[model samples]
Target: MKRLAPHSPATLACTMLLALASQTTPAAARDADKPRPVVDFTSCAKPAWPKADLAARHSGTVTLSFNIDSQGKADAGTVVKSSGHAGLDEAARSGIAKCRFKNGPGAVQMQYVWVTE
Candidate 1:
C-alpha cells in the first residue's frame, strides 16, 4: 500500500490558523488583557499517520496544549484531548512540540483532527 503523504490539509490548515492568529495582534497587547499569551505558529511539523491506523482507516482528533517559550519554541505539551488511538495522540503531541510560535506567554492550544479519505 502507498503510504499517506506526510503533509495533509488538516495539518496545513492548523498551521495557517496559528500563523494568522499570531499576525492578527501584537503579543504585548494581548498579554496586557489576556491571561494566556497569544501564540503565532510560524512553523509546523506535520503529524504522521500510523501505518496500522492508516490501513484500518481510523480517524480522530487530538487537542494539545503547551507552553511556548520567549524564543517561540513549543515545550511541555499535554494532550488536552485524546484522539482515541495512541498513535494519533503521540503524533499530535510530538507535532505540537515541533511547532514554532511567536514569542509570548507560555499557554497555547492546538487541535489536530484526522479524517480518513
Candidate 2:
C-alpha cells in the first residue's frame, strides 16, 4: 500500500483547522459573549490516522461531548456524532481526551473531521 505524504491534504487540512481554532480574532474578541471552543488547539497534539481506516479509505466527522477538569484535563468523551466508523470515532475521542484545554470545569462539545485526499 502507498503511504500518504507528510504534507498530504488531510494533514494540511488538520493543521489549518488547528491553527484557525487557536486564533482569537478581533471579531471573536468583540463577541466575547459567545461561547468558545471547549479546548485549545494551539498546543494540542494531532491525532494519528488509524491505519485500518486509512487503508479502507474511511472518512467522516465525529462530534464529541465531554467535560474539562479545572486543570484543563478532559474526561473520556462521548460521541455525539459518529464518523460512521467505530475506529475513527474512538481515535478522535481518545486523541481529544489527551488535549490540554484553555478553559475548564465545563462541559464541551467538539468535532474532529477525518478525510482522504
Candidate 3:
C-alpha cells in the first residue's frame, strides 16, 4: 500500500498559498473601507458662496462626521464642527450626503473649506 505524502514540497506550497489567499491581512482590511462613487472634490462643483458672508470675505472649515451604510450612501449624519457660516455648513452637509462609500458600515468624516479671495 502506498501512503500519501502530505508534506510533499508541491503540496505544502499549495496549502500555504491557499491559506494566505483566504486570510485577509490587517493592512488590506484597514484599506478595505474605501469610499465608493469616489468622492472627487476636484470635480465636485463648488457650492455658491453665501452673499452676505462672501461680501465680508468670510473663510472657515466645516468638519462633518457621518455613517456610510451598506448601500454606500451617506446615512445623514451631523456636522462635527461648524464653519461659522450657516451657508458653508449646510453646503458641506449637502455635498457629503451626495457621497457614497464602500466597505463601510463605519464612520466617515470630512472637512469642507471655504475661502473668499
Can you tell me which runs of candidate 2 are displaced by over 4 Å?
A: 1-37
What tens-digit string does per-residue lDDT give for candidate 2 at 1-117?
777675566543432132213224576567567554466666567788787787677888888877767788879978887889999889888988888776555566777888766
In model 1, where do residues sit more than 4 Å from their true spots? 1-42
Question: Each candidate's lDDT (Cα)?
Answer: 0.63, 0.70, 0.57
- Candidate 2 has a TM-score of 0.69
Which scores better on TM-score, 1 or 2? Answer: 2
Task: Give residue 86's error in model 1 in angstroms.
Answer: 0.7
Q: Write the per-residue lDDT of candidate 3 for residues 59-89, one digit (tens) a residue.
A: 7887777666676666766877898888768
Cα RMSD of all models vs. native, in order, equals 7.0, 7.0, 23.6
Residue 68 accuracy (lDDT) in model 3: 62
Q: What is the TM-score of candidate 3?
A: 0.58
Model 3: pairs clashing at backbone N, Cα or C within 3 Å = none
Clashes of 3: 0
CA lDDT, candidate 3, residue 20: 7
Give Cα distance to truth, residue 36, candidate 1, Å.
5.9
Instruction: Itemize residue pairs with steric clashes in candidate 2.
Output: none
Best by TM-score: 2
